[model samples]
Target chain A: MTFFINSVYFGMVLTFVAYEIGLFCKKKIRLAIVNPVVIASLIVGAVLVLGKIDYETYSESVQYITYFLTPATVCLAIPLYRQIHLLKKYPLAIMGGVFSGVLTAMVSIYFIALIFGLTHEQYITLLPKSITTAIGMGISEKMGGIVTLTVVAISVTGITGTLSAEFMLKLFRIKNPVAKGLAIGTCSHALGTTKAMEMGEVEGAMSSLAIVLTGILTVIGVSIFANFIG
Target chain B: MKYLKQLAIVLIVSLLAELMAYLIPLPVAASVYGLVLMLIGLITHIIPLRLVEDVGDFLVENMGIMFVPPTVGIIACVDELKQMWIPLLVAGIFTTFLIMIITGLVTQALIKKTGGES
Candidate 1:
């Protein structure tokens, strides 16, 4: 029992268990707000605190899990491949929306951080908060931002995106499936894509395309913005 | 055995991407490098779609589960995060809506102008 508790199995098991609980809650509530990542992290986090488990120990035990993040990101290409025809269909419209969305996400975060009196470090940390984990982590690290802070910010950003996107769509009267998918995926990454998937297959595929395009655009946007700022 | 082969293909592509990122002076993420490389390979038929379809689908479909552990890292900096909770929450919530509305509206208009489906 002690051996199982100390091994990588411990963290992996804990994560899976917590995630299952999250899924259960989502099914019960039928609310997008009940995001599995949020629920799992909160449950697992509280458990770690209550049990006196250090973050370092927990992360170390789950280190292999983190390694999968890279390959998982690579797998994102498959969806984009399957839906490449979408790119061919509406190249200009897709690029216009994705580029604009990526810029708005970062720029708004920067201005908001400034208006709210956040330090430059905090601003940088929040820069890539809307992108997927793999690309977001890479952008944050490359731009001298804190990975932990970016991860947390991304989670919050994702949760917010997931929960409020539908309302925003109605409020803005966005009726186009392509536009809806592009907006959600561009603004909130994969988490928003889940909601988009619920909307329809075309929405889901378009959102998947936006997720990859937004990531690529955001990386370039951050690099160019960094140069300008420096 | 099939799963292992698929995993190997992904890892190898990721490895090559890592090498590319190292050799290049740009700060592009290795994952992006890998993604682009895999994308080109697929488009060119150099890498068959079936080769990694199962593994790829499984990974992307369950990608959110992978983010949980890293996000739990926030526990270590709760105090520091607490100091800026208002700004953090406000910024996160506000920007999400802002981006969604703006992106959605702009795309909607453009698509309308282009004479596309709703």
Candidate 2:
């Protein structure tokens, strides 16, 4: 009973606190690493680890909240809706770029893991890392990979994308927001998108565009490869 | 009636995607199939934006919080994963990092060629 109550409170509190903290950090630190979700996730994850609380009890208590995930995913249409203009304006270019990027990202990692002699399950676990954390975690679970490992991987990749993106843009002299956004969303997923949005409207739209394209491309690429390997 | 349609579409997409996964043997799973399926519906106009606009709008705004339960999965499987820490750690970081770099570079090049916006 206590666990149930604690779990509910924990979820609610984490969301509120994390969002506020994240917003505050964004205003104060232009650096992108201070994202609310990342900050909150780390702190909350740490607390969970240290709490000695059972995950089952906690999840069961807060399952009501978690169920919102599916609907939440469907909600991505909002941003896409706003950016339909971007899609309309540069449909061919955006799709072509994003699809190719998605292909390169997934195949490159899949092969590297393959060469590393990682098991099938391990490969599946990391397959969705370039996607958002929610989707990535779910795919990881289904593919028989560690969900926690996948989440952590998602966060790290997001942070890496957020932190290193500017350096990357400058290093490679990538000037276009669409290119930058698509690149980040394809490689880093949500975290990268967050940073891309911070850079500008064009970057944000392009990043959002990349998310859709890469998600589709990766799906196709993964399916094709799954056939060849199996 | 409206909510039911929304939920049903989500389910249909999930099943269709999963079926595709089974037949295609992709490393990815069915739910992801569901995501791609929806994306296609939007792209090809199989499902009009109005049909899912409200529901999809809701899903995106709250996408951040979706990982809570799954992250909670950490506690459930930590024991099994703990035993394989080295492999999981190495594979997780290396594969993720490699994908990030390659995807970033490739997408950058693609955008340049596509010639839309800078």
Candidate 3:
């Protein structure tokens, strides 16, 4: 048992198995809330807690997997490229929608944090919650927020967007696929983009484009917003 | 060989983006620079889409699994989360709804104003 746990592959194998199970559950359940990442995190997290294995050991091996995050994020460009034509047709509408969404996310989180009397660190952690994990993690770390909390916040935001996106779009009577895609992607990042994809081709493409643009916008926006709290 | 070449293109672009991040004095993440660089490269046909498309699709498709490790780190901060979960949950849900409606309506209105085909 000691030897197996100590092996470099322990964490990696555990993560893969848990993720596979999560994938299975997602397929079987077919619910927005049945997020594979959340399920896998719970499974792996439970193993660490129950086995009394320290986070250090788990993360050391897991670093191998995380190395792909950067390259994957860079590759987001491919989808954005494929969908670039949508930007041309409704450049003003798309850009306007994304910009306003980004602004609202930052501003709303700021006030909510203040209203709740959250600590400075907690506030900053939630600041980038609406962006994709790949970019949001870096922003959180740079701004002296708890990176783990930011990750959780981001996942929750994505899930919330995914679950509510359809209902909210209908409630607001927003029929434009472009508007729907941009809203979900901007507010919830990639996870919500998954829902956007399912909505239709136009929604999916616009949402993919929104993910890249929202990430870029948040990267630039966080620095300015961080000052409000400071 | 095909996959390796596609991956190599992505890696090189990522490396260049990292270098740019270090040198550029902006507070931006390396991933953003990498994304912008790749977008420009593709638009200009300097780095053809086929060079990176296959690997890119694979990575994006499987990106969710990669986050498992970092998210599991939540174990380390259970105390902070416990203390803040209510506020965190409130802010996350409320703001998500707010942003969605605002962005959606704004875009819809703008599309109508522009007389663009929706």
DockQ: which candidate is best?
3
Sorting all predicted structures by lDDT, with the top scorer first, yields 3, 1, 2
lDDT at B117 for candidate 3?
Answer: 60
Q: What is the DockQ of each candidate?
A: 0.58, 0.27, 0.64
lDDT, candidate 1, at B85:
74
Docking class of 2: acceptable
Can you give the lDDT of residue A188 in candidate 2? 72
RMSD each, Å: 2.8, 5.2, 2.6
Considering just the first chain, candidate 1 attains a TM-score of 0.85
Cα lDDT of model 1 by residue, B3-116, tens digit = 999999999999999999889876566877888889898999898999999998888777778778877887887877776777677767888888888888888777778764
lDDT of 2 by residue, B2-116 (tens): 8678767765665676577678744454444555567667778887777776666555545555554554455566666665556455544555455545555655565456656
**How do all the candidates rank in terms of DockQ, highest first?**
3, 1, 2
Residues A153-196, model 2: lDDT tens digits: 66556666766777766777667666677777777775566567
lDDT, residue A162, model 3: 81
- Clash pairs for candidate 1: none
